[model samples]
Target chain A: MLLLQSALVQSALVQAALGALPAARPTWNLALPGQLLGALGPDLLLAGGAVLLLLVAVARPESDRHQRAVGWASLGLVGLTIVAVVAYASRGALATEGPIAVDTFRWAVDIVVLIGTGCTIALSMESNPLDGILTAESHVLVLFSAAGMLLLAAARDLILVFLGIELMSVAVYILSGLDRRSERSAEAALKYFLLGAFSTGFLLYGIALVYGATGSTNLATIGEHVARYSLMYNPMLVAGVALLLIGFSFKVAAVPFHMWAPDVYEGAPTPITAFMAAAVKVAAFAAFLRIWLDAFPTVAYQWHNAIWLLAVLTMLVGNVVALRQRNLKRMLAYSSIAHAGYLLVTVVVANSLGASAFLFYLVAYTLATMGAFAVVIALGEPGERNQEIADYAGLWTVEPWLAAAMAVFMMALLGFPIAGGMGFFAKWYVIDAAIHAPHPQTVLAVILVLASVISCGYYLGVVLTMFMKPRPANAPAVRPVPTGTFLVIYLSAFTLLLFGVLPNGFVQLAHDSVPISMVGAPARAPVASAASR
Target chain B: MYPLFYSFCFYLFGLIAIASALAFVTRRSPVAAALWLVNVLFCLAALYVMLDAPFIAAVQVLVYAGAIMVVFLFVVMLLNLGLPGELADARGLLAKILAGLAGIVLLAKIMSSRTAVPIESLMLRPDSLATVARIQGAVAPVAQPLFTEYLIAFEVTSILLLVAAVGAVLIGRRRAAAVEGVGAG
Candidate 1:
């Protein structure tokens, strides 16, 4: 009788505990191909292309002809991915489930990355052969890197972000050291790998801390938790945010963490340098904007001062250092650093207009930088000679068309008004956003202008050296321009002019692409928060 | 009486793990360090078992002490390091001091953070050992989460491994080719 009574009490306790437990969470359906494809069409396309390229590379590893063919095929695949993204954008389809997000902001960034990839492939066709990097693996690595960039831009979870970053960075590290014969290339690769791994450690630790504090890795859930719990002063969350900012600052080449940029940029293959300066920056900034705006806007006040200081220092150091650089590649590397500062200013603004401005500036910077690097590659021969600023002396006499294109790129980078270049409008948009920000960011705007004025010193210096200075008698004769390189140069220059003269269409596209739920309307909070609740 | 026994076991395993870890790091010889690390791993496995996670405990021993340590030993032997004293870091005194200072700062930061809260408070669904063992068993609780919510991460990890494998092959082949060409010349 005593044993029977004990069994009854145990049953009653079990029943009560079961009743108090939360309901079972819903499981995602991973078997549905159609829905998954609809959500991840562009990403799947890029990943498939990468795998196909890798298989082809393994099959024909020794054929230079096969490598060139793979390069062209990768370019075609990027073009197709862009078309699919545009189709999705037109349908206004968005996915907010799992670790991926498909929306206008992602599509817009995808387009930029695809265009940059296409241009890089085209530029690499002849340049890689010259630099002893013409292996089939080089083309395959580019495709994989592009896929990683797409994933980086579309990720909504911290784990996915880290994976995407590693995928992209590992491929780029290999590409940087592709010239196995050069010690400088090996040094650049080693430096990049070490520093990149260190920053990744900081990023992963920050993610772990943020997850500990908020009990979620989903951006929307973290945002909701911060809002509901008033965790603005939470020490763990603050430290995580600071660490994340440092990691991103290193990736984007912001000042104080900008030491690796110049060396890596100068030592990498010129075409790869162009890709890193353009597509990699676009993807990193995309991730940076999404995380900060979607996850931590509620506590913006805590991070705003830190970003402001980063911007000011980045601007001062980037432009001031570029003034002293004699190597053209190093100068452009510093220029890219200064551009990151301007982009950070837009991030600080953190409004719909600011988002649009950020997109526009990335487009402008990408076009000008790609065009500029094409000129650099054309000047650099098989032995990596003629990379000095003095190498551009009397380029106008030797190669008039190339000289003209280089002049246009330099003017665009300088933001000269008479040239009506895209850089001018891009800076104008940034300044306007800063002035119209919720907080008084007028001082940032003034600093931006001052930095632009300082930038003119180097930009115009390049132009003058190319056009006005006398040609060196011993200058190596200009090689015949490859068709692929010529195409990249012309396409970049034409688009820059078109956008500069008629910025309205591109501006409209960027404005329409603003992530409404996150930035514009705050009424419809991120879908993850609602669904999780 | 049961709680006292459990606490005693926990402290015993924890102390063993800590001591083994210290020895692992301080050993001058690579082989000795690896052997000490195996001891640390075994102690951790014991701690995991005491926490009613027998699955994790098994993995802790199989993966870390078994497979990983074998690989470590193989690499140590292949390298044929000349002497223990020659293996020490050749940095200046200032660099060593700075590294030590940085490590101390990191330790202090971690200790002061909220992460140092009592382990009992960190459990999402606390239960007695008997209840945990009876309700979910060892493997089911871990398997459910690993196969479901973390499925994507698991697949991505496979891709990462594949990329690393390919990169290793490419780099190794290139070095081999360069070395052979030099010898032939």
Candidate 2:
């Protein structure tokens, strides 16, 4: 095989490239292979997996056989991804001046994305006639998007950030439209693509302006240039920051730019929406945090208040709009937008606590969202989509356990204190970051809390419908449940409870991931200019 | 040696890009718009060559021009959009006003901010038109910081692209099969 040979060749090339570097001297802790793989391994493996899955799909004409192959192979590929992560993790953190920073922070976030993708794949394994479209591509796209998110989490260069954003968006564009059986999926895809391309132009223009202003795309280099040249608060620099904020805000689905969220989320399959909600948000926040952490620290005084305004607006708009949605999926979509706003408070803080809060909240949110979507996929019937809240009018009779699991997920998402729940802790961490931020980020924190209270209305609405409302006598009997759906649901629920109870494990993990002090790089001031003072 | 060849390639592509961009804006028909978009993609690929980002350029061509644009053209043809009427009637007052305002603002900003970027401290400086690799080598010191500190992040970017390709093909293939089944029926 060509596939095996290509893998070997690629690995050899990577090894050669690493060896050829002038500073190829092996650091005591990190083997060059680990260091290189930490950066490129996920991409290579996903690429290989994509090829393998494609080949397997084409090679096997039998649909059943293909589905089986897709399920196990996806599991295998995710397993390999875990191996790569472990390999990179074992090598520990490396301090380099590379365009991407690699350390525990990135590795931790990678695990959450990878796990979420794995769960989505598992939830997708049922025998819908639509599975033909939903098959291996969903897994591959999730992997690709995850890869983009991982790169974004660690990117230290504006160009790399742009590339990562495209990488994530392109895959998502196709996946969102994967269910061609419905017209809405195609509509969602088209809308997302148009908006995504427009935002990309804004981002590219911003990068050009920033490059023109600072003559660099490397965040650290730009920081140095600003410090050395005293160009902080320069008009061009300020304009560049504003444009960058607009572009990223759109990606994260912040207010005003969030028109695409409810439609796209409602249009795409529930599992895919879960991926967008959890993995995409985490990665976007990761990149957003990195940019603000490295480049905007000095000018935080100037940019801080502006971001605070956006944060408040996004939170308020997201939560308030979510209250009226009749569609459960659409409601969650609005809630997610609101959640993005809530997380924005921490990002606005842009400190050690903020970083940790983001990491912790990301994990908690991913678990809760993935768990909720898993239930949706289980309840949903073929050809008949389940967007209506009225559809769940049940005595808790058809599926009592399912209803209970759904209730827990809803409560967690609302950040309600369900006794040792991760949701409560997740919100607390974000609020804590906002409260203690070196700057006066508390006002944003107040908005975050108020928006969360508004969130309780919709989240509780889902619970009331699932439990109290009665199913009609003429309702069709629920279909036999698949093994995969059950597996995903229980796994998500277990983790949600586990993390909630043993909050410190995840808290410590989050604490360890904050990019406070990097190796081989000096602490970059916010907006100190090279020519300043 | 390589830089010379690469520069020629870049210019060739750059010309194509500019031409396509013009076509994209000028074209009245949706089909023409799609086609011009493809051309713009090709030009972008060429620009990538000059920029020394061969991988990205290749993706720009393959994914955008090759795969994505084909989809766009397919949809445009399928929709059977009729020819457009005269622009005089089509242009609403709001549209004309917005267009004028945007153009004026853009022109004003560009004219006001026309100062050239200063690069006196840069060890090697390439003009905007140089090959990407030349730009890379000229900015080798800049490359040092990117690779030395951000190397891990760089490799992860490659994985992201691979995933995008796989995701696209897989998603496309399913609908493709369904479309075929319907056609046969």
**Top candidate, metric TM-score:** 1
Which model scores highest in DockQ?
Answer: 1
Tens-digit lDDT track of model 1 for A4-57: 455345434322322121243222332354565457778878887778778888
TM-score of each: 0.84, 0.77
For each model, chain A TM-score? 0.91, 0.88
- Report candidate 2's fraction of native contacts: 0.50
Total clashing residue pairs per candidate? 0, 37
lDDT of 1 at A88: 66
Which residues of candidate 2, in runs, are more than 4 Å off? A1-39, A127-135, A516-533, B1-176, B183-185
lDDT of model 2 at position A107: 70
Best by lDDT: 1
Per-candidate DockQ vs. reference: 0.36, 0.34
Cα lDDT of model 2 by residue, A256-369, tens digit: 788888899988877788889888888888888888877767766687777787789888988898899888788889989988987888878788777778877887788888
lDDT for residue B59 in candidate 2, whole number 0-100: 76
**Candidate 1 — what's its lDDT?**
0.80
In model 2, the Cα lDDT at residue A198 comes to 82
* CAPRI rating of model 1: acceptable
